[model samples]
Target: MEFDEERVALYETILDELSPPDGEAVSSAHFEKELELENAYQAIEDLIRLGELEIVNTNCGHVRVRLQKPVPSSTPSTRLEDFSENTVWLAYIVSGSSPRQRRAQRLFQNFEVGEEHLANISHTDSLAQVPGLEDVWCEEVKGLSTEYAILRKEYVFEQADDPWP
Candidate 1:
């Protein structure tokens, strides 16, 4: 649990440069090129645990990252649950998933990548909310990259022919 300075810098750059000043939801995939598949998930997870970042599932079909603002009037957002549904961004799944799901998964539901969902999950978590339907999401969903997938859907799902392997 030593200080991860690199992770810290990654989060900082993400907030300062990638996310717009308007507080719009930005794609977490912005860090994909900068992070190795092994590190991207952990970087995001650590930032979340340290109360420095939030990964939100946009109901409009993508995963987003929003930085915690420090303005005196801004209420600090330590986790996804703390965010109210702001119409400025696409819809957030923070209000959709249960509390337990928030702890277990990074993103929720099938989301758009370049053209559609699973188009580019490299260096990011896949959409795996419920237990039983993971196989369906894994199998039915096409265009997933094998290199950087972090599957955390834990609902005792039947196995499917994993594209990641």
Candidate 2:
């Protein structure tokens, strides 16, 4: 897909300025000053789609960015099976005590519960390894725990609501 060069340039400038010399993550909102909010937003989407950048949206709706090229040396490995074995399954039951229960149908549990058995998800794909769960979506977890992790497709709500409208 053809992209607007000017907009792309603006996005690069924003990232370069906000990102550290060692290329740490940058927030997409930083482009608001140089481009209209919509254009800035699209720039980030376009960049990510083109594989020029990788994005992680935080629970607070902030888009975080990092260069896709050169790749981060410490990024989670691509081996889904390996990660799945190390994590403990925590299903997000609607009536469960966990705060994440209502946000989505179930979460691919991340974050420590102060127990050795509780597992942390290393990547989004790792959730697919969970038995009986399919079409998982990577999303930001809120409430009891704040993290960018995966969720089962059945649990992903298009509109935020209680009791699954």
Candidate 3:
């Protein structure tokens, strides 16, 4: 598709200013000033829609736009499965302790408690009542005892109101 020259130039300018050495997202404001574009947002949208650019977040105030060359798709991976409909999972980690390990311990303990509570509920009622409780599983666990924890739990879904959901 033929793209507007001015918009393409603006996108190029933005990409030049934001291209990361490590290949990361750039901010939106910086590109606006560098390109001297009056309407960066509209210009960005146009370029993206034309398949000439992509937006990346650099964790700063603005977003980065990168020039992207399209490539033809090859054979798709069959092993990839879509579980967006079947699972409900939540993960949380605590922040800020002198020793990072201690915070992790606390996070794990909290997760364990949540897991146990759900397990009890599942046993007492049909998994349907628990919403997303399919084959409940803990994918990862880390924490400092009683202080912090990181816990991940997944449940299967039969309906919108499943226990895990």
Candidate 4:
């Protein structure tokens, strides 16, 4: 399903605030402070389905929630080759188990991975050039057994003029 800009922004915001003490099932009032009822609810549902967020329990008037942080097998360093108002670069680390095959498949499909994707993987000695077809870049760090491979990718974006700038 396609997400509108607001929904995406909301998801990001929620994720950012998803630290340990943030109760799982927050009151509707608290959520309304950060997002409209419909948007907050939808974002929660999406996050839960993605396994990034989970509900622990519901109390008298609140819900307990947990936010799962992404763990990387390797640390990545970012370098800015060139910077301009029109260009931006990024790098990210990614990791998962072999049992997460379905998640990996979904990721590859969404990121436009194809035979060329495998070529990129083969060329890079380190799994750092996994080819992020999306605006985001990620890389693999290490392989855990034969079941899972940790990867990372870098992102380069051609930016546009900032209307506000």
Candidate 5:
């Protein structure tokens, strides 16, 4: 049977959060608290079925499990600092303008020239989501784009994509 990719992705993210280092046991209560879903109980079930986790023990209502495999790091190796401090990230949102991007642009407005100037900056085609930059970009873009991403930037150029980028 086919599973919803979005649901599977969400499940994976929860698993990542709960996964213990070196297959050590992690408290199931912690998982439920972090997940904050009515049906979070099923997530552990699904993970077990997928072989991503195995229940090590159960005490009362609490469950303990460990990662079957380690999750790979998503952070890039080059390090943004390896480039110039002037290096910035841009994402093309589907709509004409993004409030989140606009707000974020304002923070760097003094530093940014314009999107046209992107031609002068050295950049790569790769994309990554930056953490702890919520003040600049919206953590979630509700209407236009289904996926939310953060990029460090001097200038931004937005484009649109469906379901996933």
Candidate 6:
């Protein structure tokens, strides 16, 4: 998977809100640990430089940071078209016992053979019918797709051989 700095910043910002409601700051180490990132220091520094985070304090090489902007909580849309106009790919992780199954969200847009970017996602709603869904994440990568119709569960990440000829 490619490193998307903006998405990482958004994820970190959301995590910051998980800190105690007593106005406590979130530590940079927590972000690194939670995300299992190798270059967390650089990532955090980039976010700070981008003004998404502020170094509230530093103790023993660890830094406590604050989100520069307020993050508003959003309820998942019941209707697919109700999603924000920027939603490019709807992603999620399959529910399973493994940590990766529950933690990592694969960009499962379900495009058919020969299909590519700017997809038709009429079949996206069918994912709700499939079992063991951890959660749905709407990703805004530049813009939304063309709402092309396709099947369920297939994704670009997997190099699986298509059974259908």
Q: What TM-score, to 2 decimals, does candidate 2 have?
A: 0.34
Question: If both were scored by TM-score, which would come out higher, candidate 3 or candidate 5?
Answer: 5
Task: Residues 5-33, candidate 3: write the lDDT tens digits.
Answer: 66556655554554322234445665567
Q: Where is the poorest 10-residue window by lDDT in model 6? A: 128-137
Q: Between 3 and 6, whose TM-score is larger?
A: 6
Regions of candidate 1 where Cα sits further than 4 Å from its true position: 18-20, 34-38, 58-62, 70-165
Worst lDDT run of 10 residues, candidate 5, spans 156-165
| Backbone Cα, N, C clashes tallied per candidate | 2, 2, 31, 16, 9, 4
Error of 3 at 159 (Å): 36
- Model 3 lDDT, residue 29, Cα: 67
Please report how far candidate 2 places residue 24 from its true position, in Å.
1.8
Q: Candidate 2, residues 1-165: lDDT per residue as tens digits?
A: 222466646556655554332346667666664444557766565444333456644445557776542312333432121223323333332212222223222333443321112123222223222221122223333336444343332222223322101
Model 1: lDDT to the true structure: 0.35
Stretches off by above 4 angstroms in model 5 are: 71-165
Once superposed on the true structure, which residue ranges of model 6 sit more than 4 Å away at CA? 1-23, 73-165
Write the residue-wise lDDT of candidate 4 on 1-165 in tens digits: 125576667667766565433234454345656555456755665545434555666576544555532322122322222333222232222223321132332223223443235334433233232121123333333344322222222222435412111
Q: What is the C-alpha local distance difference test score of each model?
A: 0.35, 0.39, 0.38, 0.39, 0.41, 0.38
- Tens digits of per-residue lDDT for model 6, 9-48: 5445544554322235677687678856566666555444
Expressed as tens digits, the lDDT of each residue in 64-160 for candidate 5 is 8775433333344312212233335343331123212322221234323333222223122333322221212212334434423223343222342
| Model 4 residue 61 CA deviation in Å | 8.2
State model 6's lDDT.
0.38
TM-score of each: 0.34, 0.34, 0.30, 0.36, 0.37, 0.33
Worst 10 residues of 1 by lDDT: 87-96
Best by lDDT: 5
